[model samples]
Target: MTSPPRPEPRSRAAGGPDIVPVSPNPYRFRTGRVVLVLEGVLLLVLGVWGLAAAGEGTAPPAGAAVGPLQLTTAHAALLLGTGVLAVGCSVRRRSALAVVTAQAVGYAVLFLVGLVGAAHEVPTVLGFDYGDAVLHGGLMVIGLGLGMWMAGEGLEGLWWERRRRASRSDDHHRSGTSRSPS
Candidate 1:
């Protein structure tokens, strides 16, 4: 016979909307994957275009640091390569939070770079009298928004629950109770 229906774990807060509780970071996992994949594709296209322009002798100066942020072929290649690797890992569903965390850090760094450029008169990442201070500023905002969404998913409770479950599993293993008799 089939077992009886089980109650879904739900919001403990009074007046909170009902939710079917699952793992600690399912939402982040999915969102992070999407973000990484999209970034990867976009970067790939941009990198190819940049490299083509460079080959045609119409590319901008390589590794020029007029502004705090340097616009170089290496920089574009690095961005594209990082995008590819991140997307590959995300597709395998590995280290999602770690990747997103790193991305957040990257955004913060870029923001600082943009700020440094703003302090100078020279143009920044876009070059040709255009400064990247605004673009990086926007990236900073987007990154923070993503982080807030991830945190709003009630991850703290899930972390504690995972620790408890792991402890229980360890206890069982210590007691040599990994299996049951038929």
Candidate 2:
């Protein structure tokens, strides 16, 4: 005689009783990382160029316009440090969100400073210029947009995961699957 047929295993993606929970897309995360790395490299290059101009004693101590890039020693240092930190964070899965958020906030502040300095017609050590303002504005938008999107994705995933767990617990209770203490 044939043995009793075994029950089919339930799949996570199975319909009806089981529900598929929303999750963060791995492709989006990868794309974000790539963009972060590219932006970091650009900042690094600009920083190095600004510093080189300063070292040559050609650019003024406060600021100078090198080709299309305008920067001072302080701005150059800031860029170099930030770029390095961003690149490091991009490689680490956990730090990406924090870094992006920080970058967005920092750029916003810098953009405002540039605007104020230009309005007053007095350089405030940041080497404020139209070119600098434009760059900062663009980066601010990109960073802020990406940061917010990532944060939303994280929250969505957490909410869905909690819901999935609660559903499983309810199912377990309804099915009388709990074993009694022997």
Task: Using lDDT, give the best candidate's number.
Answer: 2
Task: List runs of model 2 lying over 4 Å from the truth.
Answer: 1-24, 158-182
lDDT of each: 0.55, 0.75
Q: Per-residue lDDT tens digits of candidate 1, residues 42-128? A: 657655655555456555553344233344565556556656666676654435445556666775787677566557676555342
RMSD per model, one decimal: 12.8, 13.3
Error of 1 at 79 (Å): 2.0
Model 1 regions lying over 4 Å from their true place = 1-21, 24-28, 62-71, 92-94, 118-131, 148-154, 159-182
Tell how far residue 124 is off in model 2, in angstroms. 1.3
C-alpha TM-scores of all predictions: 0.53, 0.71
Per-residue accuracy of model 2 over 63-179 as CA lDDT, tens digit each: 767678778888888888878877889976558888888889989988988787767755677778777888888889888877866666555652233223557767879998975
What is candidate 1's CA lDDT for residue 28? 73
Best-performing candidate as measured by TM-score: 2
User: If candidate 1 were superposed on the true structure by all CA atoms, what would the RMSD be?
Assistant: 12.8
